[model samples]
Target: MAINYSKLFNRRATPQSQAIPGSGQVRNSAGGYSWEVTDWQRLDRFLILGAEGGTYYIGERDLVKQNHDAIIRCIKENGARVVDRIVEISDSGRAPKNDPAIFALALVTTHGDVAAKTKAFANLSKVCRIGTHLFHFAGYVNAMRGWGRGLRNAVGNWYNAQEPRELALQAIKYQQRDGWSHGDLLRLAHPKEVSREHAAIFRWMLSGQDELGERTVKRKVNCAERTATYAAVGELPALIQAFEQAKAAKGKGEILKLITESNLPREAVPTEWLNDAEVWDALLQKMPMTAMIRNLGKMTSVGLLKPMSAAAKLVVAKLSDQTALKRARVHPMAVLIAEKIYAQGRGDKGSLSWSPVQPIIDALDEAFYATFSNVEPCGKPVLLALDVSGSMGMAKIAGSCLSAREASAAMSLITAATEPDYVIVGFSAAANGHGGQWGGGEPGITPVNISPKMRLAEVVKEIEKIPMGGTDCALPMVWARRQKVNVSGFVTYTDSETWAGNIHPSQALRNYRDQFAADAKAVVVGMTSNDFTIADPKDRGMLDVVGFDTTAPAVIADFIRSD
Candidate 1:
């Protein structure tokens, strides 16, 4: 597939003045007019390109402020307090135009406006793609989308129990989840689109009977054939065999459909007797089941096949074999209480606790090791610089930074014995706020200097407790070199957002050598969406960076382990 360069470049390119919107100094790039404005212009005609050329109709905003206000209220009410502070005080008119954060919050809450939301998201993706900030937004979008899907699923189940038009929105949601075409599904459910053929099929399939007395069994068989847009006969052979299993056990009437259709009890059929061999024979007569079984056995013997254990077999038996094969089990660590320390604010504590995601921790361990394999563990001191800027406030990130701290500590604990003696230094260029002291006042990048130490948990706890501020990175780079400790390697975690600092990051590293006579090398792990673009021309070492993910402990651990 060719790269979509348009996606990278086709932003509105409408840069707002650096001065606050209502400020007198808010001058245009054109260098003439100074204006005080409350809100940004709401562009009409939100469009998305289809497979063909012309843009498809998406949505329009009546007044940008109305949408913004709706979003603020909805998010506050819904308890999605990710950007609540900024959103709560937003001037609906000014906020939408100035802040993508405000725009995203509002877009999600708007009712009966799927097209608008889609367009807004697409635009947001396009704008962020040019720089490193895209990843941060991407993570948030993914989590929000997942949460929405879950909410819709619950609503659907509820509506199914109580048949009401109030739940009618759920049918659309179900179709979306299934990846059905938007236009096709909408038309299908529309009252005018209900035709004689559709009505007959609906009545027959839904009512458990058809006019021809060719009830459940025959109907399903025919329905499967029609739906079988499957390119190959091998696909869904298990389902075909399931029908035969029902027929072989008793009769090929209503019994077969009940057995084959999803969500039915297993006691309804002879599933035990209908093993893979029997099922294969029943569906694809040409395939030799005995030979296949023998080949499977050979594979198992050679360790090429991961044979399903009896417990796994039982689990698979509950669902279609295909579903069982595709379904992933929760990682063993996900359910266990991790031997790690507690995390501070962000999201429902009920979900973030170690017990809910032990499997993720285990996966992180595996990933961390993989990433860590790249690092050469030496005797020198390892410097770990953390970003604790005001933006690093737990309020902004949805438990991401907290999770990262925990995971990093966990990895450090495991590697403490083998790796270099670790020293953690927390720095923020911002000033302290009402919440707590952070980094800066002028995007003020204040770098808090901490002597390097090996205690990872203690380091994490300290960073979490303190107010995280400005992201000036140059300070830490210079500070570490000044200490003249033979630093083997330095790993810095930051959001890559920067204010005007005296030295560029690369220059700071070079300055360390020239000014301080130090050989400490560094790799940066960017925790935010902002791209911390530090290129190493001298090939001193690689700059390892990654964006935040929900499962960062595992993801970053894997990234570090790979290093």
Candidate 2:
């Protein structure tokens, strides 16, 4: 018997404008509401499902155009994929109180050897774990394979976590007290406080265990300690020269050959030397004025450390003996120092302020709308793949505490309406100790964010429902490659955290690019303040990792504008 992906998955398809399986009426910016949607079709434009029936929401033709090449490559390589279409349903009646609903659909091709491909595809359908029926599939065939099932489960758990403000208050109560060692007081604090998974990493850092290896750490420690010592003695430049001389005398045993050869009495040798910690400390008292001046320059040069502003006052006080300077008019040295540190705050804390955060979020949200904005009322279907990994705990920075899935749905629905076909997929690995159970009962995918017809605001509320879990980028990427929808590139909101799965990030990325060859691009957003260290591409491959703004919608907007 031939394997029928669409039939087996319980997926339904429609090429013309239609209502999302369970959504309500869609509303326009002008506040006019309608139930009908239009389609926008372009050459080589494609959309795929991240899940079996989950649909994409691509409302803009320009976005489809930007990623058309990538979509085609995905189709030629992987088959039986999923995609979404955000069908706007509008009516003259007042907006409904309930959120809109989402529907999933899969796009399949009959041209290829369906039986062989289906069999090959079926082998890849390993459920995340036991009791979880959701299966993994090829990227091209079911582009959005992971979205529907994966997201549904994640959002449900998040919604149940109660209010975040309350959670944060609880987190503070359980957090380690100020002076206690991170280990002694907080290793096992609840997951909400220290994050069960991240505690080990935090502990590792506190233990002085630099994962980059001891040699590098030792070198840096030595350099920092030595520099601190020398500056206290007012001989920093001389110390640098001495070190350079030692290096020049490669393989020499001792560092201070010249000082020793003089046969000078130990006491005659100025106590200004920095060999002993006591001597360095004494020097601070003996030559406090000189040390302050010298250290200021070094502090300014090295960007990491912030010397107390009082140091500036010390400089003026010490130099006052040589020249009279008025505090109101400003000193030449002060001007020089100010210029050196000018704009230092530009890329530091100020840059990370709320102003910057808002624009990025606004742009991303706009990208979601712009994607389908250019498309006629009728546009091609799209696939929305959202990451619900453990790192997404910071998904909400403003507004109501909505689940991640809800945020994705709200933005996705708008885009899906741009096209007649689409799909959605949410993904994560089995939780810690859950063994093989990833998609049912405890920790399952549920589209609570979706209503029969969801509005953009309702989508935000739904996003508050996505729970945090493992960060595995491979599953979604692989699925997209196999389910070759005429995908408008896949959009994933994430903090770039990924575990070692069946496929490494490099390998997964390579396989996708090799098979699809520019057919689609993956957009990753940094949801938290955490840094995402993506490994350098092994085979000269390039992918996009965009830090998402305040909302997932803004992330979509950024993706479209970049194209």
Candidate 3:
């Protein structure tokens, strides 16, 4: 009698993830395993998604150490390449926030070989574009390495490289951050004054006095001459001076006028009067996009964003403006967070409270859609398979309170809101601690009642009820194939902890393609900085991307539209 090999090695017999050796597979941070991403890919992920909040499977310290080890390894191999990658991400506005890129650049400055350090110094100005950036870089550098001659020169050159006006703007907008004030950096760097304007600016930076008034040229010039001279390189300084005067202005009228006339930034405004609706209204007109988004709750708390108010009109107009969104680099992730927080009428942190403006919440949701090009929706039948496993619910996306499970559901709402034909499903296996658990409670590829028109909060509430277990990324493809569903594309929004599948996700996808849809594509959107993906690198039909990346929705849509 012939031996039945299939019975001996039943794929579903094991409760734990089966990672095959030499099959280009490795165990993930979660019990499930995935095909490991490359070092370069890992670097991009770390630079974009810092290890601030640890995931459910890993703590922040461990996550940071793991990612840092990857960076160190990359530097050991070729530090110059790492520096160039940092610059490219910083310059291209690929990431929503620049801090990660800046942080990584500083790491290279401290850890990279001589060639990498040289490249980092050469591009310091590019990475640290603002005073806050410089301050952040300094904070990171101070923790890692001492202020050596190379570090000091780069710091000094940063001060000298800016035009006088630009420098003054930096002074006004970002007075201090990350415990590194301008005074500290100036005293440490001791940059030589490149021009009289620079000299006066530097002097005033150290002392409280406005040194521009004591300049010889200003004294020699007549009133008109002085006005013209100041105007030539003084617009920014004038705003700064006006900001100082506004701080002293006792009356609300005077303060409001100064804010409108000088176009003062909110930073220039005193904290005492931020609660004043009228003052916040004046600040609203010229508020940068990011500032406006952040202050939404505050504005609502102050009653400025009430129904049919002028401030409300201005906000709606701003959110709708495509050019403003692009120029501000407003990612939907930021918008979504703001919207969720505002809708909740409170913050996850702090004692602040406000009554949410329904219209503004709706506008923010709409703006989230607007960040992606007004491209025609990818008119394809796509399947959104979300990973709602225990690990996903346990680990939060870095920089956010929402876990991977919550964020995946929220992200899926975007596709449901856009595409005409789609199905939403979640996949997980029931293996509590790997004890040969069978299919008793396996909710493999369950259909989630996530409707297209459901509010985001409502959808989140609904998915939280569904039980979370082990992850099986391949279940979507396998279930769909069995159901005879002809999916144009499959997008698995997960933390990439897909270890519970009987077969690998990549193989399952290939098998599905061979049967149902020959050109079917699968996209793995990694929700955390777990440096592994279920998608095979060699497969042209599969793409992996960072979750909450501002460019992701557009990229995913455009790629799927090809079908």
Candidate 4:
């Protein structure tokens, strides 16, 4: 089941002609023109492979040499991609704690040529925001702590001087948006410039006493509101007393007013307040319709809030309103929530209940159509192949509840929604009559023509009906060639653990290109952290990408055009 790519792709270990240093060129097998393989390209492939284990076919020997210098070079060349890879790895929960932290610190402290280092720093600032703002704060801190002495020194340097001010500000903005605890903010502000700039607030946050007994919604609201007000006026002691009084008096209206005026970060608002009908009613009255629709999941999560009948009505009304759909279109989040509601039967049991209105369901279907308004149609027809193998049913996507099969279906739904002219198919090995043997059966795949007009939920339902069996990544190309389907591009969503076929996927692709369109391309959208890819290293027309990334559609489009 294992595939050693080092032996497969690299030259035999015999001393031969070596290219000039720093040229990054290697002579072809035919001893002809040299091809370039930059350090960044190697790093990109290594990341797309993800950490080994699960169903991946990649081994350690197949990867580029991972070391301090090599990692630094990766950051220098590809900034945000590297950081995003680290975050993704960390989020996957498959790697050791040290993995992401080591890479994150290297990204912050590593230097290259002067011009490159300047760009690296700029990239560092942008990624820090991504790490802190888009993901959980605790995760960001854990990664930053990877730089042992480097971290301490960097903190000291920034405190003594205004060093790494931009990075520090990004962290501050994240805290401001997320409503981190006072203690967390103080710890974050230990660096000199940040501490100096917000000295009053830091002192005030520290000066508060625990006289309020246990931390409650009223106390949190009062403290956050008072902190915001007093931080601006430098009145710490008075603010603390006021917070305590607000808590003692059970003055919800006063606390609500403070929260409203201070503009507390959404995360900072207490769950209790969010759950309160009065509080939600008041907040919903003022929030824009778009924000309400976008945050429907958060607002209606179990125990967070009872789905107010009014809120459900508002959502339905907005969905049905032609003018609103024309103006802004339903957001992807709305469609995703709608799908979840239907698939999980959330409306039947939860605090929220959908109206029996047939039009609401129709409107939801229209929302799916609206979501891809900005996605340009591909010039050439494409075929999307989804792997419905047994292994794909075994693991859920990291940090998500959806299994690989479900995620593949969802991603396929997105592709079908966007690509104007496309065909969708599900592939796996045909069932063997005897006790099944690996790679034993003839290649088999089933076509399920998904239409753009169908709702996402409907597409998912159709995808779920396909039977799961052993994986055969080569089946799609084989089927395409046999059926003579005229498609310029192929997109396969799988874990890349292709073991159930007579032909390798790369070879199958080559055969398809030779017999059919010589310029046909394939993109493998990997759904797991496995290192193995079916894409041939020698072919520029083939590519591998991580599934679920926001930029994946654009990457696929570009790859289709060979751009």
Q: Would you list the clashing residue pairs of candidate 3?
A: 32-499, 56-395
lDDT of 3 by residue, 1-563 (tens): 99997655544332227764446677787666688888777887877666778777788889888888888888888999999988876775656578888888888988888889988998999889888999889888878887777887898799889988787777778876755566666666677667777665665565442232211221111112111011122123676678678778898898799889988888878788888999999999999998999999889988899888878888988998878887777866678788878889998889989988777887887887777544456889999999888888877765676677878887777777778899998877665332222455433766889885666788788888777777777778878888889898899998787776567777788788888888899989988786788777887899998776656777888888874
Candidate 3: Cα lDDT at 551: 65
Error of 3 at 106 (Å): 0.4
Tens-digit per-residue lDDT, 1-563, candidate 2 = 88876533321321112222333424321121212111211111111111111111222343333334333334344433312111111011011100110111112222223542343223221211110111111122234333233233222222124243322222222222222222221221212222332332233323322332211312111111111000111221233233334334533233234234422222222323433333222222223332333333333333212233343333434444332222122222222222222322222223321111222222223333432223342232345556665444434311123333444444455545554555666666564312322644432233333532443444544555655556555555566566544554555554345542344333454566667645344544433222232322222232333221212334354454344
Top lDDT model: 3
Worst 10 residues of 2 by lDDT: 92-101
What CA RMSD would you report for each candidate?
18.4, 26.1, 6.9, 10.1
Candidate 1, residue 438: CA error in Å? 7.9
Per-model TM-score versus the true fold: 0.37, 0.28, 0.87, 0.63
**Model 4 per-residue lDDT tens digits across residues 1-563:** 89976544533211113322333445432121123334554344334333333332323333223433455676667655566655554343222122333344344344444444344333332333332432233334444333233333333333234333332333222333233433333343343334443444344333442122221212122112212222443333333333344444455686566446533333334455565655555555545455555455445553223334666566666766655654543434345555556434346344654223334445566664454334555678899999888777765553234567766776676667666778888888743311233344334677775665665567667778777776767788878898898888999998766555555566677788888999999998877653345665567888877665445666787779664
Candidate 1 local lDDT, 1-563, one digit each (tens): 99976444422211121222222333322221222112121111000000111101111232233434444444434323323322332222111112345335334533314544443333342232211222233233433443243222322222233222212222211212212221221122222212333332223222221232222222111111112011111222233234334535554344434433421222223544333332322222222222222123222222222334432232223222322212222111121111122112112333322211222223223322332222344555666666555444431221222343333333333334345566655665533211123432323323333322323334455556645444455556656655565555656665444343444455566666665544556666533222123334243453543322212233333433442
Lowest summed lDDT over 10 consecutive residues: which window, candidate 4? 214-223
> Which model scores highest in TM-score?
3
Off by over 4 Å in 4: 1-125, 128-189, 193-197, 209-233, 236-252, 265-272, 285-374, 431-443
As a TM-score, model 3 comes out at: 0.87
